[model samples]
Target chain A: MQETRLDTARIRAARQAIDPVFLDTPLYRCEALEPGLGCAVSVKLETANPVRSFKGRGTELVASLLAGDGRNAVVCASAGNLGQALAWSGRARGLDVTVVASRSAPAAKLERIRAFGARLELVDGDFDLARERAAALARQEGIRLVEDSLDIETCEGAATIGLELADAAPTFDAVLIALGGGAMATGVGHVLKELAPGVEVICVQPLGAPAMTFSWRRRRVVTTDSTDTIADGVAGRRPIPAVLDDLLVVADDAVLVREESIIAGMRLLLEHAGLVAEPSAALGIAAILEDRDRFAGRHVVTIVCGGNVDLDAYHRWIGAAPAHRS
Target chain B: MQETRLDTARIRAARQAIDPVFLDTPLYRCEALEPGLGCAVSVKLETANPVRSFKGRGTELVASLLAGDGRNAVVCASAGNLGQALAWSGRARGLDVTVVASRSAPAAKLERIRAFGARLELVDGDFDLARERAAALARQEGIRLVEDSLDIETCEGAATIGLELADAAPTFDAVLIALGGGAMATGVGHVLKELAPGVEVICVQPLGAPAMTFSWRRRRVVTTDSTDTIADGVAGRRPIPAVLDDLLVVADDAVLVREESIIAGMRLLLEHAGLVAEPSAALGIAAILEDRDRFAGRHVVTIVCGGNVDLDAYHRWIGAAPAHRS
Candidate 1:
């Protein structure tokens, strides 16, 4: 499939547009992990964000852009953090947001969205089914569809994370971003390529959800039959075409990290960086840990994408990991 | 009791000085609880900080100040978040840190402090004994003593949190800070009073460890026979005189939040803010929930003081909350 490159200038403009709307999360150098990895590892602490996720960056930007012409209602489908971000951002602007999620979506997350004053729509189906229905309903009602992956604005918004990172740690040799709808990787990678062209941008995906990994290898978007992972935030079935193009243009490589690695990564993030990351958010760290040699002796920054795991899930996942993992 | 008015401008100046060093932790407004309370209750999420606590603010400021003249070693007597913060900050600036803790300090915390590159000294007695040893050792080794509360720099450093809160939510009618050595409550409250004179500053202490609370009420520092609480971070016997004066000038009231309330507060911070705060950090939230009417129709901000609770302690606390209580 043919692809179009996102202009670097446009990415910078997106940064300015989104800067005031979301938190400029800190970047901290991880000395404990650095020596072991043989790399100057820095963690982009997105968990410090209002919604406890980098999704706030994209969701707030998209919400602001969509609400520009007085639109006050938005709809989306998310299993966790995305819904919370949309709800909180919508509440901030006095806009109404409806989140459609499967019955299996953690009750804690559902409660969080409600806490932010967003209307909840319990779709009696899986996340993909809910997404499809949400898209259809949004089109019918003329309500802005804030689809996480399909929307160009969402990708542009997620890309601002890259801009902030590059500005904060301009000396990094490589940037690692967790793969979801490919929006974050595409957006961040695009900007980093322009700012520091020699720097490598690596996209990390859980082995269970290797849609992006498979798609990049096949050079086309592909669907997975079954992609089950604890990293629910990034467990998308297929990649978005626009984001795929951006990924192809900027991402140097894609790394598939195991579920155990993701869990270990979360534990390490908490222990060393004083940050909490959901399984999906820790994929970048997992990827690096899985193959430390690739990042050895290099200045690297890993994005801790989000923190929205339910207590039951968190206890089970974090507990399953052996102590002294860090 | 006579108390001197605080140097409000200096407190503001200290805040500005640490602005670049400390992460601007979010003030997340709880819109869901607002309807029930008839007030906007927000959390100053110190748990999102680089060291996973507001202790980072004080530690960063102290470390920056101490390292100014090429000094490299600093020592502290804390087994909780303060030790971890000082250790992390020490490593970041190429300084060495030693944390002295009682033999009773949790093994988990000792492990974390070591992981952050701090030398650990486990004294034979309780925390007070460990503190005494740390002070003597600091003098003998020519190491700077990063006193948690007694040091003027420590109070000034903690005051930045109040400045950040005022900047983030200037209209807040009341500010709730967890009472420790009275440093956090004193420093933060001092600034809040100066920034917004009408703002009521209330200090919350754990019922079991209420030395600061007792000191304020008695108009002099008082020692408890035995203090035990889940909030180990705020479990101190003595209140620094300077801190007591600051508290007298700015603190409108002091409340003792029950242990059960602290547990509930931790769960709420985790579930709502996606933050992992220790019991001490959640004291302010506990105070609000326990006495919801006190803040009705008012805009209130609570400083989540710190985040260094053992994972097991967190699990046990959150799991053990009685069904009737919640």
Candidate 2:
């Protein structure tokens, strides 16, 4: 995968696209968290949104752009929260949205997405197949696809989160994000590097699905033999070449956090921070906790990406004895 | 308990005396929540603090007042989250804080309070005895009492949350608070009424310990014979006379909510709102969901008081099946 260099102009456009409604959330310096991480840790609590995820920023911006063409129908394929976000954003603007998902998607999320007035297209296959089907449907209907990855506009929209982060807490030494399709990390990193030139952009992946990290190191698009992690949101089998290139070009560091760390991160965010972050959202913090020495005394920001986990799954995950990170 | 009859001046004084470190939280309208509540439901999300509970607001305010008198020693009696907040606030201000708690208090919370640099005074008896011992120690040492109930400074501190709600949100028809010692209700209600006269204040109590509700109905303080519920926060045997007086004067309604509703509320807040609120914080929402017809179309706000629940307790409660309210 060749690096796709991103410029400040694209980031600037993203900022304009996501102003007013998309807020610059608080860059809180967590004193308690700082000591443990051995760094002056500041969290960009992306979970503090009306939709409870940083995905809302991207979805809202994308929806606004799509609304301009007088085409009301939007389509997307998601594991859970992204679909809910698209439906919600579309509903807010009086637009119709269709979300395609596999049967493996969490029931609560499917119910919620439908409740947000989105028509559900259930695919017999998994997420990749669902994405392909949704793309085809969007093309057939000439509807706007709020695609999770491979869309420049969507990545630009996601980048606005980084723009907001830079504006809110400019003195960040490093920033962390969970890498799925690499849309969030690429977008956020592009904006942050342009705004704060020397700030380190860190991307975290679930150990079970460390495709982005491996791809970045190998300098080639490589898929894992099998992807298995509790953090389904950041679990992706195929690495988008363009998005991975963009992520590597801007990211200063990348790490893979274990499943146990993800659970611990979820508990910490919920118990100490009063945030109900999904497993994907907790990935960045989980990485930090796993290797605290690497981030000590540096003003760091991490995104709590989404909050769309099944309660039953969450109960089992947090309740069971944590699996040791081998 | 006779109504204290606080005028605008008293409420204003309360607001002024409280420290500004604890932010005036947002009062966002929950469009999703409006369906069941029958009214425009707004939630004052006090769990958005660094400490993730409304207790930070009151604790900071009380700590500031104690520090102003040059008293280094501060003492409070709490089950969990409150103790942590007090310890953190006390530590921040360079004051020594002593937290007295029973053995029933969660181990995690005790550890957290200690982590925050507070001395723990574990009692052999229950919460009531622990509180009594704390009060006695405070009196003996002449240390400032950062009491949750009955302290003028504490009530004043808690009142700032109300001021923020009135200033942030649209004028509401009613306000709901999960009542324990009546500090939160008294403080918040006092400000809401002063700012918006049309607003009616409502206090919600767990059926297991209906001290505030009982007192509101009987016009006198009543001690419960026995109390055991999922909501450990609002399990106080008796209401503080001083704050109860304020509740009587300002409150327009008091309702008892079932424990199941509290659990449901916690789950909803976590699932829908992406907030990890304790059962006490969920009480107001529980009341609204239990009798949605009462809240129809009227602008209503519920204070999410605290988020210091034990993980095991939270898992057990939220995992259970919903029960029909009596």
Candidate 3:
């Protein structure tokens, strides 16, 4: 296996370079959740930041580097969270940001992107098509294309979350992370493996969009015909090559949770943790709920990554009757 | 005016004695909120703690002191959040806690109080009557009365929030705090006045429950016949003597906001900041929105102090059409 690009030294520096608003979020033990799961669970709250998501850490670091390199403009394609992060971070650094979002992107997230003063381009396609369009736009003069999972700086920046967890709760038996474009899992996994070598790093993906999980299992990039999940943040159809490469080296295990479980996890977070987590960010909790016996009597940590759910959708998802699962 | 009992020295010690879960919550700028309000606003998010409210800080400190003084049991009367805080803190210290609550207490909060291992006693009267019953119960053998705002230790513990805000954002022109039994306002106001002397400390109360506000304006304790508002946390019928004393010394001004404005603030927090703040916690934002002309071009800080709203109620409140407010 090829050596991982993320290291402790780079992660330490990224911790300093990233914006302060995105760093050192609260990592506390969830009293309401521990008894039911029969384990000690610590939640790292990433939703408390300016953008209400963990995407700002990686996007801010990447945007700062682009600014330092004298780049005038940057382009990216996102489901929602990444676009908002890039737009906010780019505006902070006085760099122009153009986000290519799928036409089906949630209105709440789209509003945030425009609110951050970033130019938004809606593409009549999926996330992959938006990425293709962003790539083509990057070829224009003085434009840098920054992909979420493929960018090494973005991954290293996200490693700061691992550094924080290690400092806050070093005795965890394992850490559960939501897998989207794979930067979160790869970055956090790389640092935890180095600092807490005995701690297992598990990646969780929604069953509706298991592209990254399938690719990790097969040891190759995989593309799905369709991605159907309420977790729009993690519903990518194609896996990025660099993200898959990093996952192969860093992730110890991967689990898939049903869509219904994800919705249940979202409600649990709101009811117990007083958190308003988007569907994608709740996958880690969903994974633990789905396989409770494996985590029983163990010290575990899960990242509550984002809280950008639409109010209407949140009400519908939480209030709806539980779907019958065979 | 009499010297405030809540000094910076006590606040500093309380910071060390209090539970770490309630300390150093996120203090960040709200980009989406700033443009509309025409002022730079920073939010101190107290809802991120385990209890999902600022009550944990005061309750934890008081509980520890009770344990140190060889107390075996304690009794308190609360509308909701305080009971949960005491129950959780009491359990941590191995002290039995009995909470006297009114029948009108939110069911969601009652469930949490029980979940934290507290004995609940329902009274058929209002919050003040519940307090009277709790005071009588404290006369029992081996039971101490733990009053929310009257306890100097509880106020001192809550003062740690002022310490954190002073350290985090000291340049604010004014700080808007939600007034509930006057403990939060008195505690935070006391410290901010000492540290940031020029920064105005404004206390916000619902127009329906103007006990503290009326008392502050009258320069003495005031009682109201009935308290009616959606912000159950702050809807107190009478002001505690000790709390009113502290507020007289520390609070610069007090304002009353309409119930409709409070609802608007709650919705704004959810839509703009992605925070699920309870109605009481949204008072600071409500004050700003109701009188936007006063805060224009100024740096202000608002404490989003709690996130204990029920999901069903949250949906109903946010989904409802805007009331015709002139």
Give the best candidate by TM-score: 3
> Best lDDT goes to which candidate?
3
**Which ranges in model 1 have alpha carbons more than 4 Å from their true place?**
A1-21, A30-40, A91-96, A114-125, A270-276, A320-326, B1-8, B12-21, B31-39, B69-74, B89-96, B115-118, B138-144, B320-326
Question: RMSD of candidate 2 to the true fold?
Answer: 5.5
Query: B165-191 in candidate 1: lDDT tens per residue?
Result: 777655678888888887677777777
Candidate 1 TM-score for chain A = 0.91
lDDT of each: 0.75, 0.75, 0.86
- DockQ values for all predictions? 0.19, 0.19, 0.37
**DockQ of predicted candidate 2:** 0.19
lDDT of 2 by residue, A90-133 (tens): 89888999999978877877887888889999998667778899
Estimated TM-score for each candidate: 0.88, 0.85, 0.94
- lDDT by residue for model 2 over B51-154, one digit each (tens)? 65677766776777777878798888986777888887888889999999877776766877888889998997666777898999999998876668687656
Of the two candidates 1 and 3, the one with more favorable DockQ, higher being better, is 3
Least accurate 10 contiguous residues by lDDT in model 2 chain A? A317-326
